[model samples]
Target: MIIAVIGAGYVGLITALCLAKIGKSVICFDMQTDKIESLKNGIAPFLEPGLPELLQEATNSGKVKFTSNINDLKDSSIAFVCVGTPNDPKTGSSDLSYLYSAIESLENVLSQSSTIVIKSTVPIGTGEDIYKKYPKKLSFASCPEFLREGSAIYDFMNPERIIIGTRNDQDKSRIIDIFGYFKDKAEFVHTNVTTAEMIKYAANSFLAMKVGFINEMARLCDSFDANIKDVSLGIGLDSRIGKAFLNPGPGFGGSCFPKDVKALSTTAQNHAKELPIINNILVSNQMHKEYLADFIVKIAQKYNQNNIGILGVTFKANTDDMRDSASLTILPMLKSKGLNAIIYDPAYTNSKPKELDNFNFVNNLQGVLDSTKIIVVLTEWSEFKGLNFNSDAIIIDFRNIYCISDMQKQNIKYYNLGRLNEGAN
Candidate 1:
């Protein structure tokens, strides 16, 4: 069957490429001429592992094609709308403009009775609202994506569960057949559209809570002189509290967590209810970033160093996304305190972002090592794992990439997230 994948952004591109991988004849359509041109040349706009290779293979096999013209999607029977639903700044609810716009664009070219699957994360009740508007023109299904940024390809191929939210049995079966390879291993969850939408919001908010809870524990560990890593291990072994999303990092900053958490909270509030726990997740995460900034300032003051070296800037490693990274918050705080930041991220070797236009950007890791004696490890990239530093450097390992034991042997002073034995020989 010829399937049309809408939008070519991060999730859209991943969806289109993975759909092609599953032997579907995919026509991936986007409005941007530049993005379509790049895809035609096998160049993905964003850095995702295994995506470029997959794109090349799929295009070479004549299974997929990218196009700027919407009419290219004329013959497609199934249209998967993978457009973005970013949170609206004013309402803290999702801006459905992109979702609505994608539908309007599809309405122009999609064949009558074509099935439209929403792969984007949207607010609850969106399905019912859409069905009321386009009942005869199309068939609707809510099949939200749960792919992570770095491991998107693997997650798509081996999903833990594939939720197909539709009342129609034929619609469900046909959609399930699109991902037929997953039936052997993945659970096929059947739900109404509203329930499926709630599931996405619930899952993302819960993961965000785990991150906020751990960071809060890490702060308590700081006060009590305890090791959070050991505490994490202790709680994670209970089986109820699995060791996922338990890593203590700067903050939860990606496209999904921050946006979904806020959108869910706003949704609850709209229903005349209060979600204190969900509300506190965002509050706690923001406080965590500010707390880390204050801690770093105190460290810089103790070391008497105005020039601080920043190791990484991306939210996490392996992808070049900086949507809601804590670096965006923490770096500006340091600059406001008159501290000079010398930042180096492997992703930004070509050029730095305009948000960080004021801070000095170094082309290499060695540039950061040479310019400052005080260093702060922000994002834990793979390249920073085995880095060797010499001389008397004071390092604050936020992501805890460096070993405290090894730091002492090298005569470098190091601090990490509540590891009590960081000082001893």
Candidate 2:
């Protein structure tokens, strides 16, 4: 099959590479010529584990290609619109200008009728709207991606469920054949386009709510002299609320959850419906970002040291994507209150942040740990577990990366979310 994925961002990049790996000829198109050139030379613009290797293999095998021209989709069997739907700067609603442009451009370039698949996380009824406006009678499906950043390739190869949102049986059969590369390893879910779009929002919003719920509980645990880790474990064991996304962190921020949740709320409001609880989850997550800064500030004052160190800066480990990262928000809050900070992320080298001036990016973890009086474990990178700590240094573990058994023997004051300490909660 000849598949054309529009937009070489994370979603489009992964989709193209994965499809190529599965013996399909894929052309990943992007707006930037530089990005296309980079991919042609087997260099990924962003950091994702296993993507560069797969890109090299696919490019060598002549199964995957990158292009800046939409005309390349002329002979394609499927054109997946994987472009980003960023939120408007003024309004929180989804900005569909980029999405509509891709659709119109592909419409002009398409030589024959083809099925259009939406891999982007868009609002409900967007597929129907596009179907109405399409120049030709092109079949459409809303097959949203549920792949996480660090584990996109693995998730793609082993998906939990493959959803095909088309009411027509013929359309569903075509979509199923496209997905048959996975064989019986992936389950199929048949639904309407609007319902499929809503599934993406509902799934992400529910995960966001789970994180917010735990963070709120952590706050109360701090006051009542309770350990939130134990509370989370006890609750998670109920079988109804499985233990995942329950661990408290600074907040949930990446390419998907934050934007999708807000977009969902905005979509609901447009229909004269209310999602007060989901709205609260989004607002509460912002507050959680501040908690990391507050914890670092208090630790700095306690140790009487103005220097602070950060372990990881990415939104999550294994991926070097920094969009909407909690560290971006927390680091500035610490620096504003008179604290010198140095950061070290395994996936990142020495790139100075444009907005933050008082921050220093170091090459090695030891370089960051040696100079600062307190170390903040921002993202739970696996290598951070090997850092040597000073007795006087304060440790603020946001992601609960440390081994609980070893923490008991350490002389440094360790403060973690959901884990109650000895003194006054």
Candidate 3:
């Protein structure tokens, strides 16, 4: 089967490469000529583990093709719309401009009875709207992607559930057949297009809420001189609470959680419904960012230092994505307070956050530590786990990468979230 994936960004590239790995011929379409050329050379535009190897193998086997032309999708029976739906700054809603452009570009090129899958995270009713605008012979399905940024390849191969949202039975059957490669790997859920769209928003918002709730608890733990790690362990053992998203960190910041939570809240407001929990989640997360920034400022004042070292800038470990990262907010807050920061990340390869255009970014971990007085671990990168700290240097760990007992044994002054007494050893 010939499958075409549009918008060769993270989701589009991963989807195209993974599908090709399953022995299906795939044509990946993108507007960026450079990105297409990079993919054709087996070079991924972003840093994702296991993707380059799979892409190279797929290209070498003649199973995958990358092109910037929309006409390249003419022979594809199934075209997945994996374009981005970034949050609109003005409306605080998901911007579907890219999605619309992708669809319009392929309007004349796609086969008469082709099946179009909406893999992008979008507002509800988008699939229905597309179905209404397109030809009746063309089938539309809302199969929202649930792949995590760092572990996208693994998630694609081993999804928990596969959702196929379409009104037509034939379309559903054909879509199922397309994903028949994963029949035993995942459970297939069939639903209407709108419901499928809502599922993505609902899942992301709920997960954001969980992260917010735990961060709130971490704050309380700090106040009460209690340990948050033990609390998380206790609650997570209940089976109902689950261990996922329970770890306390510098709030949730990624491509999905922040944008999806805001989009869901905005959607609720448009319907004349109030979502206090959702609204509070956003507020709490923002407050937590400020709180962490303030904590850094206080530490700098106590240590009589103006320079601070930041260990990681990416929102989370394993990916170089810095979208909405805590560093973006915290670093600006610190700068406003007349504090200097030297930042380093293992994944920092020429991709600096636009917000920190003038900020100092170091390529080596030792460079960040040698020039700064205090170390602040923002993203929990694996290399940071084996780091040797200076005994006199104060370490503020937002991700809780090190244990209090270990830091105390080394007589290292450390502060971590959900720990008591600000980690004074």
Candidate 4:
């Protein structure tokens, strides 16, 4: 089967490479000539574990090709739209301009029997709207992707479920055949386009709510002199509430959770409905970010520590994505209060965020640790564990990366969310 993936971003590149690995000939198209050229040379633009090697292998096999021209999509029987739907700054709704442009470009070269799959996360009814506007010969489906950034390759190869959203039986059959490689490995869900779109939004929003709920619980645990680690384990052991986003941290911030939660709330408001839980999740998450900043400042003041060290600036470990990361908000808040921070991340040693252009970033963890009196573990990177610590340095662990007893045994001042005595000097 010949497949075309639009937009050479994380989703498009991974999808094209994985499809080629599964024996399908794929041509990936992106408007960015530089990104296309980089891919052509077997170099990935972003940091994803196991992606560069996979790209090299696919390129060597000659099963996948990268191009900047829309004309390259002519031979593809199916084209997957993987463009981004970033949140609108003014309205907090998903900006579909990129998706629309991709559709327009695909429409120009679409064959009579070609299927256009919407793999991007979009609002409900978007698929129907596209199908209505496009020619009858072209088919549409809403097959939203659920791959995480760091483990995208593994997720793509071992998806839990494959959703095919189409109205026509012929379209469903065609999509099934396209994904026949995963027929036995994953569950195939056939549904209408709107429901499939709703599933993506609802799934992400629910996970965001879970993170928010646990963070709120962590605050209560702090007040009542309880430990969230124990609380999570006790509740997780129950069959009804399985543990998965229960671990407390600064807050949940990433490419999908924050934007999708806001988009879902906006969608509900557009329909003249109320979503109190979703609204509270957003507010609570914002407050949590501020709370962490204030907590760090309070600790620094208590110990008379002026210099701060930050570990892990990326949203999560194993990926270099800094979109909506907690460090983005927390570090700026601290800087505004005249506190200085030296930051370090394994992936972002060379790159500086535009927002944090003036901030200090060290190339190694030891440099950050040496320059600051207070060490803040912002992102949960595995490399931060078992590191040598200065006895005088105060450690504020947002991700609970270390045990409270261990920190106490070393006689180091350590603080973590949801643990009692964290605020005590």
Candidate 5:
């Protein structure tokens, strides 16, 4: 099958590469010329564990081609739309401008037998609306992607469920054919377009809630002088909780959870309905970020040190995605109170984000080690584990990557979430 994958962003590119890896001929298109050029040379603009290898294999096999021209995709029978629906921080609503653009662009080239599979996470009833808009020839199906950033390749190859949301069996079968080898990876959920759209939001919202719930409990643990790890283990062992997103940290931030939760809440508000839990997830998350900043600043001031050390900046480990990391908010807050940080993360050794131009970054772990005052571990990268540090340094392990006993043996004061930071008081 000649597969046309649209919008070559994180999800789209992964979709294209994976389809190519499955031995299907793919033509991936993106409006961004720079991105298209990079993909043509087998270089992924973003970081994923197994992407480079996959890109190399696909490129060598000549199964996938990247292009900026839309005409290159005209001959494909199946088109997967993987554009992003970025959420506005101020309005807490998703901007579907990119999705609309991709569809309009696809409409010009899509054939009568072509099935437009919508893989982007959109608001409910979007599939039906798009079908109505182009009812002449193109058939629509909502096949929302649930791929995680760091492990996108693995997740793509082994999804827990494959959702095909279309009222038409013909449309559903066409979407199913696109996942030829992956149909047995999990259950094939055939449902109406609305139900499939709601499933994506519901899954992300619930996961975000799990993250929020654990973080809130960590706060309570802090107040009561309790250990949150034990609490998490006990609560998570329950069959009901099942223990997936229960890890306590600064908070949850990524492409999916934050945006999807906000969109779901915003959708409720637009319909003049209320979702108390969904609405307050963002509020509570922001509050936690602020509280963490306050805690770090208060504790760091005792040493009267102006320079602090940061271990990670990306949202979480194994990928270079820094869309909404807690370190972005917390580090700036520390700066406002007169503290400078030297950061080192495995992801940003060669390149640095221009948005963080104000802060200083080092290319190696030893650079951050130069500052012995206080070291804040932000993202929980595996490289930061089991490392020796200066004996006089103070450690604030935000992601719980360090051992409290090891810190005590070295006579370094250690503070972790929910274990109680006596230094803050």
Candidate 6:
């Protein structure tokens, strides 16, 4: 089967590569000429674990191809819309400019009776709107992708469930057949298109709420002199609560959770409905970044130094995406207080970090630590897990990289987001 994936971003690239590995021919369409040129040379625009190898293998095998021309989507049996729907500045709602553009572009070239799948995260009722736009000539379905960064290929290949929402039985059957490429590996759930769209936003918002709830607990624990790790462990052991997304950090900052949560809340308010939990989740995460900034400021004030070292700059480990990263928010707060923060991320390449202002980027770990008075473990990379803490240098381990026992044994003054410090021996 021939599949065309629009927008060679994280979702588009990962989906196209994975589907090609399963013997399907894929054409990845993007508007950026440079990105397409890079892909043709076997270079991925962004750094993702295992994607480079997979993309190279697919290209070598003649299974996958990349092009900037929309004409390349012709003769494709299935078209997947994976373009970005970034958050808007005005209303915090999801901006669908890219999505609308993609549809209009496809409408000009799409073959009659072609199936279009929406893999991008959109608000509820978006599927119905898209279905209305194309009418009977084109088959539309909302097959919202549930893949995470850093592990996107694995998640796509081994999805927990594949949900396809269609209004008609014929459309549903065609959708199921296309997904038959999975060969019973994934559980298929069929529902109305609106429900499928809602699932993506709902799932992302729930995870965001969980992070905010734990961070709030961490704040109260700090005030009462209690250990949050112990409390979280006790609660997480319950089968009902499950321990994922329980670890608190500077805040939840990534492409999906932050944007989707706000979009979902905005959608609810538009209909005169109340979503206090969702609204609070967004506000609480913002405050969490400020709290982390204040924590670092307090440590910097003690030494009377204006320089601070940041260990990791990305949102999470194993991925180099810095979009909406908590460090971006927290760094500005520190700079406003007269602290010039130096950042060191091993994956900092091809992107200019100097343009961010009030911050200096270092390529080496030792260089950042040597020049600054204190170290802030922001992203929780595995390399930061076993650092020597015996030095008198103050450290604020925001992602809980150091255990309380080890920090005390090494006499390291450390503070974490959720866990209380055991104090230096």
| lDDT at 170, model 6 | 76
Error of 3 at 322 (Å): 1.4
Clashing pairs in 5: none
State the TM-score for model 1: 0.97
Can you give the TM-score per candidate against the true fold? Answer: 0.97, 0.95, 0.97, 0.98, 0.97, 0.95
Residues 158-197, candidate 1, lDDT per residue (tens digit)? Answer: 8999999985777788898898888888899999888989
Which has the higher lDDT value, candidate number 2 or candidate number 3? 3
Task: List runs of model 2 lying over 4 Å from the truth.
Answer: 353-358, 422-425
Ten-residue stretch with the least lDDT total in model 1:
416-425
Better of 4 and 6 by TM-score: 4
> Model 3 compared with the native: what TM-score?
0.97
Error of 5 at 395 (Å): 0.3
lDDT of 6 by residue, 1-425 (tens): 68899989999999889888988888999999999999999998887889889989999989999999998887887789999999998987789999989988887788876777888998899877876776545777789999889888989999888989887787788768766878578989889889999988888899999988898898778776687888788889998998887887889998888889889999999999998988888899999988888878877776677888899888898888888888889988988998888888877733445435556887778887788758899887888878774377778888876777777787767777656544222
| CA lDDT scores, all candidates in order | 0.88, 0.84, 0.88, 0.89, 0.87, 0.84
Q: What pairs collide in candidate 4? A: none
Model 5 / residue 130 / CA error / Å: 1.5
Per-residue lDDT for 1-425 in model 2, tens only?
Answer: 68889999888999998888888888889998999999988898887888889888889989988999878778887788999998875777889999999988888887555778898989899999998887686778899999999998999989989988985777788778878987679889999998998889899999989988998898677666688888989999989999987888888888788888888888878889887997788789888888667867877786688988888988899997777788888888887899888888887676654544457889898898788877889899989886668766678888877765576688777878767754322
lDDT (Cα, tens digit) per residue for candidate 4, span 99-214? 98999988889788888999999999999998888665478888999999899999999999998899899889988887899988899999999999999999999988888988
| Clashes found in each candidate (C-alpha, N, C closer than 3 A) | 0, 0, 0, 0, 0, 0
TM for candidate 5 is: 0.97
Measured on C-alpha atoms, candidate 5 has an lDDT of 0.87
Best candidate, lDDT-wise? Answer: 4
